[model samples]
Target: MGRLLLVVRLARRDLRRRKAEALLLLLAILAATTTLTLGLVVRAAASDPYGTTRAVTHGPDVVAVADEPGDPIARAAGVVAASGPFPVAPAKLAAAGRESDVQVVGRDPAPTAVDQPAVTRGSWVRDGGVVVEAAFAADFGLHVGDPVTVGGRSLRVVGLAVSAAMAPYPGSSCWVKAGCASGVAPGTVLPPGLLRTPGLIWLTRADTVELAADPVYLIDLKLADPSAATAFATVHNGTAATPKPGRVAQGRPSLFLQPWPEIQADATRLARDSQILLLIGAWLLALLAVAGLSVLVGGRMADQTRRVGLLKAVGGTPGLVAAVLLAEYLVVAVVAAAAGLVIGSLTAPLLVDDTAGLIGAAHPAMTWATIGLVLAVALVVAVVATLVPALRAARVSTVRSLADAPRPPRRVGWLIAASARLPVPLLLALRLAGRRPRRVVLATASIAVTVSGIYVLLILNRFLNGNGPYDAAQVRVLRHVLLVWTVILLALAAVNAIVITWATVLDNRHSAALARALGATPGDVTTALTAAQVLPALAGAVLGIPVGFVLFAALMVITDGDGDRVPQPPPGQLAAVVLAVVVAVAGLTAVPARLARTTLP
Candidate 1:
């Protein structure tokens, strides 16, 4: 207990003295944890609105449609209750100077036991007025008393409502004509057609009959065991070519069936896409965090060498010294993990669809599993970065550590000979880079990660802007995902550049002061420090271009397997990105290098 308390006090003092670096460490872990939490929770958050809508509307377990009109309930087994055999047909709807293709459903004025559309505004289906699906109404900015032209006839919007029969607006499950498919398919781009982005409207039976002479019939069923829907759909649709002795045969009347699980999955498709992207981005950020923290730990190790020696001289064991060094980061990691959990939970709902009609206000739930995962990641980052450095510091002899003099640079005969002919800044940068080759590699890798992320962003931006299958809303959602990823990547990369430059300055301060005494100007020392980082940034940017392409291709193959269809970014754009990254790195490192040089004794 005495040793533990002593370690805690020392760690606390160290953290307070290096407040900026401690904060940077905290932020690095926090960024990764926040992104990980979002990836884990987005899918569940998206389903909240649908679940609420389902409960409010008494949504069906399965919706079945047949061309030949008959009793839909009689054809299916295990149904506790059923509604519909309502008339459905595709038609054009024009309102507020905007025209859209819509599937109009004709229902009786009275409600049924199952699959009742919950009217959220105005009255239910009347003689000449129509009730629009709530999400659809909101998309088109329509309200009660607004005039709409449907199927060549004018009608006032009577009500707005929500139902669990299908997905929300622009994600309906039924199409107007053959070849216009329903439900979202992986990698399926929307072909130009009537059903690509459709709306839903409700009308009276008489009005629907007047609109379409031959309308399909729909039946909504509530099953005793909702989980049996897939089996029920197979049997009802007669999809099995070889039936059992008492089963229905293939080539029967065409029946379209949508199970509830499918409906819920469709509702969360946009969220799923965002989730996948964020999860990938979280991993990338984790890699950056590791690199950044490793460099930071190395810097801290140099700064704390004498402190370690002093403690050892005062009878502190190496184990106690190591504990003190590691404890500071562990405490910061814990705090960062907690902050990430709170922020991520509160921010997740904003990424989901939460229109008033689709769902009530979302209350994001934080599970113990999520907390455990986040903490595990944060601790892994801290341990991976700090362990080796702490151990090395602990193993140093007390007398040598207490000497507190800068270590001599290793001799590299060829490097010195080659650099002697170069300009002073370039010569100093090359010598400094060769001095700490491992740190240079890490700095290069950090820039590569950032540039690779930017490259992927460019590809995704182009894909979203192109004529691929997503609607405007989906495109917007995907763009939001890209924006989040870009912001985090750029911010962390900027932090890394400055940190690396500052660490270089600190490690070379003794040499720099000697150079000044030997007539090397402050300007030359600052330029050398900045140049060391800029050279690595340029190489990283160049290497990152191909890595980004490979990563984007792999992600596309995993998500859609349509790499051939994805257009490659132009060469000029990639070049521009590389140039921009180099410039940004130079700029980011400039202030830190200048400050370090100006403060030199």
Candidate 2:
């Protein structure tokens, strides 16, 4: 206990002495874990939003539809409750000079036991007035008291509401007997020529009957065991193939049953897409976190040699010294993990797309599993960067550490011969990078991650901008996720570039001073430092293109049934992104390189 307390004190003092450096390390790890927490928490909490609509509306467990209005399957087994032999008819709805196909259902002023829509605005079902679905209303800019016509008859928009019966707007599939077709409706195949992603509306039974001389009916059922809904639906649907338009039943009419779980799955599909993007962003940030740690650790190792010498001279064991060094970062990592988890949880509901479609805020509880994963990530990053350096520092000879000696540069005949023919800056840049091959490798990886992220961003941005296949609301949800990912990726990349540049300058300070004394100008030193980073950025950007393509290809296969139909980003855009990355690296290196050239060297 005594020894452990001593190690803690040493670590705490070091952190206090270099508060800015400690904060930088904190930010590096926090960025990665926060994004990771966002992905995990959002995935867990997405279903709850649907549950909000379900709870307030007393959502049904099974929805059964038949061609005839005479209650057919309401008496089926496991049905504890039921609502509707509601009249439904497909009609052209014209509002604000635009028209769309809508499945208009008739409802009463009295709320039913199952699937009663909770009105968000104005009032509910009244004679000669229609309550537009919340999502549909928002999409068409329809407000309460606005005029809309159903099958050429005008009615006032009485309210906007949400239901647990079906998916929102474009995702809400057809219930009519004639069927519907829409590009956004994946896995839904019909006999063709019914409707295209129709919106939903509610009206009175008298208004629905006036719209269609003859109409079909829909029934909402609440099962005794909600979990057994799928089984109940399967048992009722039977072996009968769907009846054609205007066809009648042979014995039992083909009653199509849709369970609540399926509806929830459809509604939460946005969560899956957002999860994919955020998880990928989390990984990219993790990569940057590693690079940032390596750079900071390298600079600190150089600065602390004399301290290591003093500790050893005072009879401190190598293991004790190493523990003190490791403890510094481990403490910070734990704090960052906790902070990231809290921030991510608070920010999650804002990232959830289509807020208007679902009734409540989604705040997922932080599971033990999520906490463990994020803490593990933070600790791993710190260990990977600092372990070797800590061990080496502890093992260094007392005299060498106290003297603060730089490592002797390796003599390579081929490198010397080749660099002799180049400009002074290029020669210095090549030799400097050769001296710290590990740093160069890390810099290359950092830039590769950044460039690959940019490559994917361009493709995804183009896809979202084109607005293909998905509903406008769905697209907006996806776009919100993508936007979050893009912002974090770019922010971390910029920080990494600055960190790498500063580390390079610190590590090569002795060599740079030697060059200046040998008649090389400050401009030459600055140019050399900046160019070294540019070379790695250029190579990484090239390699990142193929990596980015591979990642995008995988996403296409996962998201689309026919991956070939998804458009590819143009080659010119990719080339432009690479060029931009290299230029940005050069720009980022300028300030650090200037300080080293004019002052430190």
Candidate 3:
């Protein structure tokens, strides 16, 4: 226990001394946790709302609504449910100078629907009383005692209550096309504009029976088999609620049945899509983690080696040393995970509300299952990233570590020898880079991954537009995004390239001096050094394009039935992609080469 305490203390001491690395790790985790929380919370809410609503409402297995009354299917359901044949229509409401379309169910004085809101204040009906949804009433500043008028009929607000049926489960408003201006009057109690898109309202069964209206427009069927929603859809296909063989109203298509599972499927897909984006965000955060930790681990290797030697002198076994090192990282990761969880809980609701709007659903309750899932993911990342450095620290040899110098070895490559005739600055830069191939490679790889992701994101944004390649708007957005991402990647890669060149020159100042003695010109040396960096830059860029495509394809979700006007990828663009990558690589190395040559005495 004492030994363990010492290990923990030492680890904490080391981390405290390296504040920069700790900050990077913290930022990465913070960003990742925020996105994960938002996505998961919204996803949970989208799939299912509060259980109370589910239990009390006992919603229909399938709701089939028609634009007009007179549908064999709706008539049948009304009779079976022992509910009234209700008259439902889309109406425009103009109250207090606020205009919004709404569904107006012309109900009979007698009611039959089981899910009706219990009236609180006014009479249920008297030819002058209208029962508005509690949410709508609140929004419009209406109360039971208030007087209002709809559809040319002056009415008193008689009731105020919550109704399960109207609770925006499949969101509050239905989607409306660009234009739907007709069939609405200035003072009419019309269906909310949203209702005209796709909605339901109910009238009294007596009204339908007296008007001899064939309340067959559509109906909600309550079924025994939740699992048989699809089967029931098939059983009833083309039978009743479906459009009569060739019936078309107002040149619009007739209504059809949509089963519960079908609605749930759409909801589930939307939720999953949002969550997938969060997963992507999480991975991106992991990459940032790698960058920060790699620097920390790399910087601390020398210290770690000396520590290993000291431990050995004290007779510490290899296993003990290894545990001590690894335990520190484990502790850091655990603490970060805890912090992430708290942050996620706070931010997840925003995501839920946004996604709920997309899927036509309400916010869901948070479950322990979801919390567990997110934490599990966070811990996995923590473990995977920290294990390697810990193991390497434990295995250091005492004698060699004690003898090791702080500076990495200086080595010369044939390319460096050939470029000796170059100017002094050029020679210095080339020789320095030649000595540390590993560091250069790591830097290049980092740049490549980031650039590839950006490129792929551009491609996806274009594909998502779904406009023909010729569509100016599609082309405009795509081009702008692509250009921005390309410029950003190029900028980062250029910095990395210059840094690598400078690092090489710094490392090889002595070799550079020797090359000058051997008759190398500064210009020759600069070109050769720049070539070394360029080789890796070129390789990385070449590999990035295809990787970008593969990543984008993996994230894409293909759906059918949206018009097919999108343009195909042009062959010219393919060539341009290759050319752009090559130019970027070459450009990355050019600036440093010029600087190396001009700055050398």
Candidate 4:
């Protein structure tokens, strides 16, 4: 207990002394944890509103539409109650100086036992007036008593309502007609953006009949087991091939059935995609965290060496020394994990679609499993980065540690010979870079990760801007995900670059002083330090272009599984991105390098 308390005191004191580095570590891990939390909670939160709406409206287990009127779809097996044989037809609606395609359904005046539309505003279906789906109405800024033109006939908006029988508004499935092309030759894929965004409206039977002469029969069924919807759809849609022989010979009405789960999934597809993007982004941020923390830990080892020696000289055991080193990061990791959980839980609901007309807001519950996983990841990052160095420092002989002398730079004959012919700045930069090749490699990798992320962002931005498979809301959600990813990546990379430069400056201070005695100016040394990082930045930026492409392609395969067409950014844009990264790295490292230069002997 004494040793443990001693370790805690030392760790806390060290953390207080190096608050900036500690904060950088916290921010790095926080980025990873927050994104991981979002990925885990978004899909769960998005479904809550849909479930609430389902309960409030008495939503159906399945909805079936037939080609002809008076079709007995309600007689299908497992159906205990049903609504409609209502007339459903496609028509055009114009309101607020804007026109849109819509599916108009004619419902009876009286409420039914199942699949009732819960009217939230004004009266239900009435003569010469129409009710709009709540989300669809909100989308177009329509309200009760607003004038709307349907199928070229003027009508008044009487009510706004919600139904769980289909997805809200534009995400609704094709009910009035087949929305996509029916057939095509093998290997000839259809172009995307085939489905037009459509809204839903409710009207009286006479008004619907007057609007469209051709109409389809719609039925919403309540099943004994709600989850049996898929089986019911298969049998009713005739894929099961279990229909009676006489009915098949008589050419029974063609029916299209949509299950409630399927509808719910459709409604939440944007959230799902956002979740996937965030999950992938979380992993990328983890890699950056590893890179940044490794460099930070490596640099701190030099500063802590004397402290380690003093502790050992005072009779502290190696295990105690290592514990002290590790404890500081563990405390920071726990704090970062807690911060991430709070921030992620609060921000998750903002990304979810609020189209489902539920009574309350979504509060994504933070489960213990999620917190444990995030905390574990944070600890792993800290341990993986600090363990080897801490153990190495702890194992050194007390006499050797007490010397506290800087390690001699390796003798590289060819590097020295080649660099001697260059200008002083370039020569000095080359030598400094060769002194710590591993740090150079880490800095390069950090820049590569950042640039690759930006590259992917450009491609996604282009895809979203162009007409693709996604709708407006989905595009907006993905853009937000990209924004989050870019911000985290840039911040981590900036921190890494500055940390690397400062570490280089400290490590080379004695050599730099000797150079000054040999007539090297402060400006030359500053340029050298900055140049060492810039050369790596250039390589990383170039290398990151391809890495970004591969990463994005892999992500697309994982999330969409060959379904989406992943677009590649233009070569010019990629080259420009690489150039910008190099320039940004030089700019970010300049301040620290200059600061280190000004303080040198």
Q: What is the C-alpha RMSD of each candidate to the true structure, in Å?
A: 5.0, 4.6, 9.2, 5.3
Please report, in order, the local distance difference test score of every candidate based on alpha carbons. Answer: 0.82, 0.83, 0.51, 0.81
lDDT for model 2 comes to 0.83
Candidate 4 local lDDT, 1-601, one digit each (tens): 4887898899999999999999999999999999999988998898888888888889999888888777777886688998888898778899888987688899988998888889989989999999999878877889999999999899999999888887776566667653432112223444442224558899998888887677777888899999898788877785422221011111223687878888888777667878888887898888889888988888888788889999999999999889988899999989998899999999998877666344345668788898899889888988887898789889987887889888799768999999999999899999999998888888888888888888878877866675344545656777887788779878888888888888888989998888888999999888998999999999999989889878888877765533244467778888888888888888988998888766676
- Model 1 spans with C-alpha error above 4 angstroms: 71-75, 181-194, 230-253, 466-480, 516-519, 561-567
Q: Candidate 3: where are CA atoms >4 Å away?
A: 1-3, 47-58, 64-216, 223-257, 264-272, 354-368, 406-445, 452-546, 558-601
- Per-residue lDDT tens digits of candidate 2, residues 169-233? 65675677666654533334444537656789999988888888767788999989999988888
Q: Top lDDT: which candidate number?
A: 2
Task: Go through the candidates in order and give the clash count of each.
Answer: 1, 0, 41, 0
Spell out the clash pairs found in candidate 1. 190-469
Q: Write the per-residue lDDT of candidate 1 for residues 177-277, one digit (tens) a residue.
A: 33243323334555554343568899998999888887777888899999987777677765422111111122224677777877877677678778888
The TM-score, computed over Cα atoms with residue i paired to residue i, of candidate 1 is 0.90
lDDT of 4: 0.81
lDDT (Cα, tens digit) per residue for candidate 3, span 1-601: 5887878887788678877655545545455555555556756665554233334445456555554555565444322442323455444555677655555555556544533334434556444456665445655566776766554545577765443333332223221211122212223343323232222222334332332233233355565555665666656554222211111213223455556655544434435444565665555555545543443444455457877778877888877777766665566666666676676666544444332112234454556776676566555555555556666766767786666544556666686677679756555545555566666665557555655666555554555553321123223433442443344334444444555555555444555556667787766676666666665655665666676565555665332211222233464664565566556655766676666554453
